[model samples]
Target chain A: MKQDPDKSRMNFPNRALKWLVILMVVFLVIEIPLLISHARHAYFKIDGWFAFYAILGFLACPALTFLARGLGVLVRRDESTFGNEDDKTLPEDLDEQLR
Target chain B: MNNFADFPPALILLLGALLVPFLKPSWRSVYVILLPLATLFYVLQLKTGTGSQFNLFTFTEEPLEFLRVDKLSKAFGIIFSLNAVAAFIYAFYYKKSTQHVAALFYIGGAIGTVFAGDLLTMYVFWESMAVSSTFVILARNTEQAKGAAFRYIMIHLVGGLLLLAGVILTIARQDGSIAFNGFDFETANHAGTWLILIGILVNCGAPPLSSWLPDSYPAASVTGGLILSAYTTKTAVYTLLRGYPGWEPLIWIGCAMAVYGVIYALMESDIRRILAYAIINQVGFMVCAAGVGTHDAISGATAAAFCHILYKSLLWMTTGVVLYRLGKSNLCDLGGLHRTMPVTTVFFIIGCLSMALPGTCGFTSKNIIIHAIEHEHLFWPWLLLEISAVGIFLAVAIRLPYFLFFGKDKGLTPQDAPSAMLGGMALLGFFCLFFGFAPGTLYDLLPHEIDYHPYSIAKVTIVLQWILATGITFIFLKKWLTPKPGISLDFDWFYRKGAVQFYRAADTTLNGANALAKRTFIDGFVKWTCNFFESGASRSTAWLMTPIWMLQGHNAEEIDSLQQSIFKRSKRGAFQIGITAFCAVILLGLLSIIFLLE
Candidate 1:
């Protein structure tokens, strides 16, 4: 079963991801005409631009991700010093149980 | 004031909670539920005017407005009391009397702070909230919690001290007119006002102090965490709206908080702590709105705070349920709970949507703040708020739920949360959608009448686009965004590790000085005096006896030898009793002769 899951993981671009990409495309298409009306209520000139918020949103998460990752040097620390917080709660053979 | 009708509604919860420990569980549960329910009704029906005034200070003509009822205070009071009821339901089965009482005090303190007409009353309730909530953190009963609770109280105590100093200074300067209002520029620029702002900002989880919320809240008991997530920071937001509206510095501060919260929350691992950080992000919107300080902006801040409490508490309740069942809160340890805890899963999604997607209270309330920012033409803040909003969606609405519920199934199978928890979540979840669909219901509760309709097609579509775009990005970046089994460092480092270092340095420096003092005074000067006294008797006796022996023509060498022997013996405390007694007699006889002459 583990090998089967690993083999599946080796496969590129699963069905769920493919479906998500398709959904994004559809959403972008639907957002286009609405953008005209959205632009009318725009505060800045950029709001009238093509999918400004969508473009902003597209990069925003990744930007934040990279930014956080860069700052991870400052933020993250290894748990090894404390050694296995989950072990305190989990059964002793939890790894075996999983396998 | 004499009539029961005019009694402070907050006291209803505060005094009513005192009887909890004495009551049996069944009665206690019912009583806890009824107390908040009664307060909720009372606050909702209260007219917009100050009453329950008392002249605590004879020097000042103004009496403290104990029950200051207005649109802003009433709105907060209503939600606080309502959440109190829901929290009691959630805690009904917790069975810890201390947790229940602490939760009540926390809620009452929040409500009192909301309705306080003056800085003094507000500070009292503010401190009460601070202290009681510390107990809630202690309710977790883990060593990590004990440490976190200590740090939590330490930060809040500092904040409280700042607030107290500011209140006293401001009140004293104003001839003891203790009424709370937005600080004007002359007042705002001063040391006292700045201290007050810093104090309130500390509680708001602004920079350098932002880590306290996440550090502490996750360490609280499940229900206590929910109660905590609902109250502390939101009260500070309310106070900001009341006192520091239009302070231009707040705009920058709020934006910093907005982005800071998102980035840190995204980095967090413990699901409850993740939600805890998200609370700061949500409060950041309100804080920013308070900075915007227009009529609509204040409304936006107030509305955001109100909606935020419901949705955020619902989120906490859902996560609380997860934490309760699994005995863990980290995402690395939790997954596929959607299958077993379907109701909780659904509620969790509602909470996520309420935070990000359209047609939820998150959409409605957040839009109001964004709308205020847009109308005010604040470009940079608007940009940061937008990006932060998307980041929030990705982190909480998308990342958190996907991993905890829908991700790969773990081998572990924990049962669903108890019905009481589901009931609490459902209460808030219903409102999350209710207000989203009909924002007019919420808009009417704002401090000022707002013509803002949050469900514009443009707003809805933009939120939808961000959701889809962010959702796609999350899928692609899943591996990168997945948290490792570690905690992110934050400013709490100052007190956590730095305080230990501080204590060590202090210990070394202070004790080093103490040791030096001991050596210089006791050993060097005092010890010499001790030795002088110890040998003085024998030395004096030898001197006296030698003089007398010389008068009798005894040999000088013999007298000198006797003096040396006496000195040596006395140094070791080996002086003969006879010689000492003889010396005392001779000294007495000499003193008598001197006295007779006198």
Candidate 2:
């Protein structure tokens, strides 16, 4: 049997991940020097202090994720909770409508 | 003078919509596409001044100017027409003729609202929009669509009534002119202007009622969602820009909506609902800009609204494609779609232009709003905007596609979207980059002249770094960030459940009381009266028959039959008399009470 060509080809996501890391490194490297030299028209000088947006961006995601999780608990319901009596249980003809 | 200039562009679309149902099936598609184009050509040919006029009624002395072609109206008119073209193209394959008719009337109403020269004209078109858009929702014909459409129209009906009340009050207070122009909140001495503002805010997806956007939009048909996304809130934004700019309270309200939208979107499982919340978040930015009311702020707000219409609709269309092919839009059910549907994935990535990435349409427009905020030095609002920006990236731009295309590979294989859809997406995709690479084309269409540059080394670098950092955060937290399958509650819960419960309780209590009254008073009284009449009649008959027997002049059988028939007639008459007396007594009581109260 011939060698599997699929195995020989590099996985697309893996290669993309590798390039993404490289791009991130390049961006961070460029960002650091620019942060040192940039003069921002900020209301407070501290707003322009090194890598402020980067830190804000870095922390906001996880903080929001957890907050959303907390919110999800208070607000979460079964998907069937919305709509009227007909929607609570899928209709017999729903599959036909979808097609 | 009823010259050619007297013809309103909206009339073109409206008249064409009336003709759609009569056309042959093959001709219907051609008719739909040509209508908007014809309206667009008419819009372009019009001059920059009020022309069309009609005598609305005797209530107002001066005739209403139905077409107002100022720079502001013109800008919105152009975008609304273009969006109609894109929407019709995307929905080219839809077989429901009713949907096309509703969409056309909806578009006409929006265009009319923008071009309206007086408050009366605006109110007329606003209600038209409400009715037509409800039909679009109802066209889906699902049970969910029916219920959601009812709720949606009920809310809009309230909004419309508020608008009408405001217009009437304002005209009564202000010399009966009914002019549509900016109101000075600083010197606003009348309640009419306030009522108008509240009405406009209702449509803007402002707080307390903002939940309607997410509650109803996802319940629409795939094509319906795309059309719905473009018109309603943006027209409200246009109205705000026209009438309530520089009102400081709007700035805070807008900021609240921006953050509130992203927080809820993060917890949503359905892809369409997430996008619905995103519309509110994006409109919040424009609302804030309108509140700022500076030259640059207004320009930025308008530009952002225009850009938003394109990108948001593109996002809706992409999700719609998924919904059409895979039969579901919940994140839990979709995975590894990119392997089979590469073109759709690429189109979706293009649709992420609203994330404000560099070299996308969003960068060119959204930065101006931030710049305006910074220039104004509104520290708290600016900081909140920055935080929300990252939230948008985390919740929508990064989260949506990652869950749909990447991760766990749920082994679903669906075909790519049809070429017609791809063609429609390609048209919008072209503009996203077209405006991105060259901002001048978009800038030239603005209501004001401005000198604002969107791309600079510092700005580009800052944006890139922030996105990358957000990316890194997601990478580390991806497992925990996977969307769970559930529904999130919203303000609509108060109306959807609380109000519904209150109505239920009230209905049960009143109905039970009604039944009790009928059983105890009406039925019992009728029964007792009948028994009393029967017993008295029998006793009298026995007494009379004893005397008649003594006379011995009549046959006993004949006498007995006559007596029985008389007794039966008397019983029937007694019931009728009792019912009549009861009704008459109640009516007299009610009349006496009214007289006493008066």
How much DockQ does model 1 earn? 0.36
Question: What docking grade does candidate 2 earn?
Answer: acceptable
Worst 10 residues of 2 chain B by lDDT: B566-575
Candidate 1 lDDT over A1-99, as tens digits, reads 355876677765686778768866777685765855644477988876666777787889899999988888776987543233232343211122222
RMSD in angstroms between candidate 2 and the native structure over all alpha carbons: 9.2
Candidate 2: list runs displaced more than 4 Å: A1-33, A83-98, B1-6, B533-598
Candidate 1 on B199-310: residue-level lDDT in tens? 9999999988788898888877778788899888989999999998888888888899989989988888889888988888888888899888998889888888888888
Model 1 misplaced stretches (Cα beyond 4 Å): A1-24, A35-39, A79-99, B1-5, B186-188, B536-598
Name the best candidate (by TM-score).
1
Q: After superposition, how far is residue B254 of candidate 2 from its true place, in Å?
A: 0.7
The DockQ figures for the candidates are 0.36, 0.35
Best by DockQ: 1
